[model samples]
Target: MRYPSKSALLFIAAGALSTGASAHMGTDLHSHGSFMTGLLHPLGGLDHLLAMLAVGVWSAVSARRAGPALLWGPLAFANMLVLGALLGLRGMGGAVVEPMVAASVLALGLLVLTRQGMNAAASMVLVGGFAVFHGLAHGAELAATGDAVAPVAGMFVTTIALHLSGVALGWSLRAANVWATRATGAAVATSGLALLMQLA
Candidate 1:
């Protein structure tokens, strides 16, 4: 299994630093950078990051028209997440949301790594369904922060970029070797476990 090349790790590190810098400069959920913070919130956590990337990697492993669907799946998730936040904002639902999101991560990662011969369409439907949990989490956080549109927009774009980057890397690795893909799936599942632990 290829660990993230030093360069890739370094790149992620740099991106994290950039987000931290932006966040500290008043982009937290409370203030000026609320929107930006909302976008970065997903990447800011390990569970969400790995689960989202795993979605793409798992999608590519299946035998369908994987590329466009893989990209669209996460985007759809983010969109729905915003809608969920709106729901939360209106005081409709609360609690257990993050746990469900983490559970989706665990389930999807396990599916991608262990299940074989499942149809590609099935995988798409499964992952897309899980994405709603993720989207709601994003939306709920954004709604709570009450940041203006611009900051949230900034955060949204940055996060989508991270998801796409994960998808691209996952696809590239899958092209290189099947084991690499399996290894990624395992790592992603492990991350889901970690998220569950935190919640517990």
Candidate 2:
């Protein structure tokens, strides 16, 4: 039996997803710190979404030979995000916080762009570090709330969804154009660079 083309599948996947988050730094979304906010957090921001997508896709691409990164990679990220939120709640993240956040996106995008074969364990560690900054961003926002349970729950759910979507995209793109995916990585990396420049 013949299967549908990979590009066609990707097109369908892309069209199925949408988000309404903004990318403006210093934007405070701590209106109530509800679960819905946390769940929608990652889904709202373009940069954060790109980073998560890159992580999932990169993990998938690298894991093709070994197995599937559909679980461990995101687990590492989710765990580290909890730790990062703790740091933010404790007021531990210093001035370098925002830069690190941008760096996380840039680094993840580069990973996807390179498509260098990395063991799943190593990839988890790298993406775990990136997840910390991402968590810090969210935690810093909810620092005043003092309750991470609902928000974290929301965030974890949204993040996992994004990761899954990325996994699908990576798998589909594999049968499509590797260069096109790489081009996506390049664009994401460039956005991170532009953000960093703005920060500086």
Candidate 3:
């Protein structure tokens, strides 16, 4: 009997991971009660984690041909994440935040999968648009607590670190195997789709 191809195995892994895409925790900031909680928030959820990493991967992959300028995608995401969180603290951008967050995961995954490219402005708008929802989710939850500065700061720093990690992974994958990068994208996209389904 023949073993599954790498792509098949990758997709299987993606399916396994997506099976539990609850998207976000429903707990309040007071429950966790620390900046570290906010810092760890993104990593706590599959939806946020994949989308954040996808931004870095897409940025680095695009930058391979577009020059270092394409790295701005991740920066755009990080900046907008803070903006979104602040807006969320104000109780804005709440109604559709979850759907939008899941959509970001799907969209960013496709970008990496297809190796899509766009001008700097368009890229920033796209990534930043999605980041707002991620931030909004965080902000909305934390809004009830009345202490957002420290948590948001933690999230901001963590977001940058996650993006940098993704960029490194993207570059390494690009050098070793383009198929692997696309496969990773495919996995991310699958997770996003699963997230959307769960939200629905």
Local distance difference test values of all predictions, in order: 0.57, 0.70, 0.78
Q: Stretches of candidate 3 above 4 Å error?
A: 1-16, 25-33, 65-67
> Candidate 2 clashing pairs?
21-44, 39-154
Model 2: weakest 10-residue lDDT segment is 12-21
Compute the lDDT for candidate 3.
0.78
lDDT of 3 at 187: 81
Cα lDDT tens digits, model 3, 1-200, are 33334533443374358557467644543464368867876776777877887888788777746466756888999999999998998979846888898888888888888888788899999999999999998887777766788888888989999888778767766675667767777888877888889878
TM-score of each: 0.71, 0.83, 0.86
Give candidates' CA RMSD values in order: 5.3, 4.5, 3.7
Ranking by TM-score: 3, 2, 1
Model 2 TM-score, 2 decimals: 0.83
Best by lDDT: 3
Pick out the ten consecutive residues of candidate 1 with the lowest summed lDDT: 18-27
